[model samples]
Target: MDFRGQISAEFLLIVSFIVVIVLVFSSIAGPQSQENSIATAAREGATGAISEMSYTNVSMKPMRVTGIKITGGSNRVISISFERPVPPEYRALVINRTVESLLTVSGVKPVNSTTVRLGDRTYTVQI
Candidate 1:
């Protein structure tokens, strides 16, 4: 083969290879970015629930949290229900709902009583 023709073929092959790599990487990255967004939103929602100091704030439009429900209620016992949707990238996305309150009024210390239900799986955390 002529040297010039060989060089042209090599250049084209390299360019095509680069394009394929970019497309593959971009496709993988797209889903990961979505997952991060959902996770961040969920974390923000949890923080809002704690900082606002009320389940009502979590439901408010200002907070951007959705589906806040009081599944059970009592003076000392309260069951707040909220679901955080998992990112689309996740095949089995988990929805977590937590119920927490101030365990001590004097110190304003939150006694974390959280119940997480992720894709029908239930877990509890106490702090």
Candidate 2:
């Protein structure tokens, strides 16, 4: 038996094992990272929409300041909640049109609903 050949084989095996471990770790982290990215995008879009939107105040003047919370989970489910001070009229419009436009999935559109639960380990994009 050539001891030199055995040593080379052992070193190669160790290196291959390390590479496999790294690959496994990365694969595990990939989906979570992707979810984070999605969250970031959602936040930015929602912020833009809210900033550009205005609701008429009691004085009948367009008011641009309001709280909008948009939460999107997996399976293309979105839940939009407005602050207590937001006007109901604008809330409906935002949920129906603006949010749907913002989160345009391939074959699905957002429907007005109150349910937010999707599944376990959901990635919630809140803004």
Candidate 3:
């Protein structure tokens, strides 16, 4: 009886199955984990920016954030836009301290120019 050969073949088959399963699981989990990380970063950044801009300048009445948008694909650029426009002086504070810093900590590179529109005062930052 050649039971030794049969046992070896069964062991090899089980090991290969486990390897395939691990590869499949890794492929499924990789992008999902990245997406979750980006979402967390975006949410935190937006929240911090809103809080900072809320009472940034005591001279003017506290500003209200109308809305926030975070958009991007995995392993690509991420953009965070705040609905309310901030004062010129506070733009640097929001972008540099709140948004950029948070995104950088999450390993995202923010674009150089952060645009503040005229009417809505919307602030957009690309990472």
On TM-score, the leading prediction is: 3
lDDT score for candidate 1 against the true structure: 0.39
Estimate every model's Cα lDDT from 0 to 1.
0.39, 0.46, 0.54
Off by over 4 Å in 1: 54-127
The true-versus-predicted C-alpha distance at residue 17 of model 2, in Å, is: 1.5
Clashing pairs in 3: 85-121
**Model 2 over residues 1-127: C-alpha lDDT tens digits?**
6587888899999999999999999988976565454444444444445555643234433334233343344544434343434455555544434344434422223333312222233322222
Runs of candidate 2 with Cα error greater than 4 angstroms are: 54-76, 80-86, 92-127
For candidate 1, write residues 1-127 as lDDT tens digits.
4587888899999999999999999999975563344334444544554444334444433323443222222112222223443223321122222222221112223323344332222323211
Query: Residues 1-127, candidate 3, lDDT per residue (tens digit)?
Result: 6587998899999999999999999999975675565445555765666576665545654544444344432223345455555667666665555445445543444444453221222234552
Worst 10-residue lDDT window for candidate 1 reads 99-108
Cα TM-score per model: 0.42, 0.52, 0.58
Once all C-alphas are superposed, what RMSD does model 2 give against the true structure? 5.9
Regions more than 4 Å wrong, model 3: 58-102, 105-107, 114-127
Cα lDDT for residue 35, model 3? 56
Ordered list by TM-score, greatest first: 3, 2, 1
Task: Estimate the overall C-alpha local distance difference test score of candidate 3.
Answer: 0.54
TM-score of model 2 vs. true structure? 0.52
